[model samples]
Target chain A: MVLGGLIGLAGCALFPLLWMLSVSLMPPGAADTLPPPLLPQHPTLANYRVLFAQDGMGRYVFNSLLVASVTTLVSLGLNLGAGYAFAKLHFVGRERLFQLLVGALVLPAQVTMMPLFLLLKWMGLVNTYVGVMAPMLVTVFGIFIVRQYARSLPDELLEAARIDGAGEGWIFLRVVVPLIKPIMVTLAVFTFLASWNDFMWPLIILTGQEHYTLPVALAALSREHAQDTGTMMAGALVTTLPVLVLFLVLQRHYIQGLLLGSVKG
Target chain B: MRPQRLTGWLFAGPALAVMTVFFFIPVLGGLALSLTDFDPYALADWHNLRFVGLGNYLVLLERPAFWSALGNTLYFVVAGVPLTMGLALAAALLLNHRLARWQGAFRTALFAPVVTTVVAAAVVWRYLFNTRAGMINVALQAVGLQPVDWLGNPRWAMPTLILFAAWKNFGYDMVLFLAGLQAIDPFLYEAARLDGASAPRRFWHITLPMLAPTTLIVGLLTVAGYFQLFAEPYVITEGGPLQSTVSVLYLMYDDGFKWWHLGMASAIAFLLFALIYAVSFMLLRLARKRGAA
Candidate 1:
């Protein structure tokens, strides 16, 4: 009975993904036919070819990669510095300021969309890649994660560096950063996947088709090509493949970060 | 001391500045915007903006569409949370069993959906539920059951979104529950068994009580997370077949971005934030009381 239940659970979990792969390779219109074939009798790459060759999917892929990477790099730098400071610094009102930031986490990001659009518009950044990447540049969760990790660092290490005449900037860059490398990687993965999978902000800010990220592009494609099941599935595959691979490779850290973010909250 | 204080500010300066300009300012500005009559007219001309205090909220309260969106959102949270949590608990229990085999593979497969992009999965699911030439209908036909228009029909549209929400989110809760289950001491179950408790009684008496904290946390997190339902409906139904699946966030998006009703959109966003805060606060209070009891 236990074995049977496990098999059933696994099958239910895997069916959608396997079906996604199967349909992506099937001959155009094959999976949509009567008694949907478990295995495509005539497998082909026509759908994928159409997506990358003519549909500007390559450009969208590049845009997703570029945006996610830049956001990850920039946010990591900002979060690590701020987190370490909040953790170890003896500045005035430091505790109050940190509390303010933490308290702001409960305010949903959606609440700021309207005015943020206007703000970006005024800055002449709307419809640009920077606009698409701006709101995500410094996440509260990122700062929190880094701060939590940084708080556990030994105070004597910092004092030793200070007594050795290491400047504050030098301590941050040379001492703090190297010690926090693992959390930085975890933060990078988290930020990258989030920025890549982000739909609403990019969908709102990046107006031009040329600047459309994968999620926004796929959403548009789905709307325009609702009847084209094969092509849509291929688009879905392209949009989801990278992050899915990233999650599978670094799933331990990703899941760890998820629980950390939730439980800490 | 002076240099250390300055250095701390220097380290935190960039992040604080970014959050202030991008996050905090916009949120406060949104609140102010909601009080004014801001729209496309105001976008084109400053003179068109008028200070209309509480006007947008009042207008939204009266509007049928707003109420429908609120109702739809409530329906989603009410239905989706339990379904997802139940499925997650069941999965966790099955995985926790000593008799279960190949637990690693089952765990990974179950979690596969959580990692996939929401827009992409919604797109695939859209096709899966298509009325004609869709697998769901084809299966129904084979089984001598009638095919339901999953996304097209008003009655089934919201339910379809709820089902998709469950499929996408149960994995997250499953992982949390698994962690919680592992934290449970094996001796508790042994004690219950030695006391002549049946399997069901053991689960109810020992397991449930021990898992309360986990359940509360999971419930609060799920409620807050699910309350912000936007991407699924955006990609799946586009708030439609008659706006049956329009969520609060979706309403804000349409008003703010689509129709350029900035003021009204800001009101919707704040209302959503308020609702989530209230709901989560009450749940946590209830959890605390239950814990004390």
Candidate 2:
């Protein structure tokens, strides 16, 4: 009975994506009819073609890719370094600072948006990719996750590297990096997925249509093409597919990070 | 400073700098801005800004729209939290059961929604819940029932948002609960079974009690997340057929960005922060009380 229930719930969870994929493949006006077609009798990529060809979806895809990739690359380094330091290195007020940051998590990102926008404007980054990327460059949760994982790393190895005359940066590069490779992947997937899926910040910061990431662009497209079900579904598929695939491929690391950051931490 | 301390500072500097400059400072600055009448005029010229000293908060308190937004957000949290947690706990329980199969595939399928872009998912939901062309309506009509206007009706709009929120989020909590369940001693369950306890009794006596901390954490996170309801409403309903779905954050966005009432927007943000903090505090207290009892 429990197994049956699980299967049913799983079906409910998976159906939206299946329905989306099926409808996106439908010919124009095909889904507008009564008793919506479960499968396109003659599935076509026409909606996808329209999205890319006419709607400039390729540019938004590029924007999302560039932002998520760069943000991931940059954040992995920053979060790892800070996390390792918090775990191993001794600093004045380290505990207090970390606590402060963690406590600040309750303050929603929306609170920062208005002033962050002004600050970015002052820095001449308004409507730029940099503005969209700025707030995501370092995240408190990312740092917390890394710190939790990094604390589990043995101190003997780090001391051995130190006694062998390895500098902090060199130790981090040569000794620590290899040891924390699992977390690196986990954090990378976490950061990448987060940056890819982020909406409100990007929507607020990237006012220009050209700079809009996939979510922002998809949202804009949705508002305009609310009536165009097939094309909109195609847009939804395009925005979702990459992150979905990434999460599936890196499922282990992602779930590990989720558990680490929430339950165990 | 000692070399070790200096090294620690160096390692932590970049991330700290980014967090400080981009996030921490803005949060404080937002608070400061809330104290003044910061409007577009102030945006153009800082000279136009004047100290209002809780004036924005007072004004927001007086505004009916703000109250309705708060009501709408509270409605989402009150209704949505239980639904999300209940589904999450149910899924986690089922996944954790001995009879469960294809566990990995099931986990992946369930968690997929959590990873999808909110705007994209909202778009899919918007279409799925569309009045005439939507598959939901089509299915309803096929069943020989009257089709409901899911988004277009004020009464149904918030509930639709709640459903979307639950579907999007429940998996995250489910995963957390799975971890919690695994941590429970198998001996305890074996003992309970030997004591002639039925499955339901074992669950209530063992599982729910054991899972309380996880439940508290999940509950807090879900409530906090649900409070910040923006993207779904913005993407799906645009806050309405009649502004019935406007959340506190939505109001803040409207005030801060759309109207350029930065001061009022900042006030709204702080108010939301306080609300979340209070709710979390009360939840923790309640959990502590339960534990003590």
Identify the candidate with maximal DockQ: 2
Residue-wise C-alpha lDDT for candidate 1, range B96-140, written one tens digit per residue:
999988887788888888888999999988888887767878888
- Candidate 2 CAPRI level: medium
**Candidate 1 deviant stretches above 4 angstroms:** none
Q: What DockQ does every candidate get?
A: 0.78, 0.79
* DockQ of candidate 1 against the true complex: 0.78
Cα lDDT tens digits for candidate 2, B36-122 = 999999999989999999999999899999999999999999999999999999999889899989889899889989998889899
User: What DockQ does model 2 achieve?
Assistant: 0.79
Colliding pairs, model 2: none
Candidate 2, after superposition: displacement of residue A104 in Å?
Answer: 1.7
Which digits, one per residue and each the tens of the lDDT, describe model 1 over residues A138-200? 988998999999999999999999899888888888998899888998899999999999999
- lDDT score, candidate 1, position B239: 90
| TM-scores, all models, native as reference | 0.97, 0.98
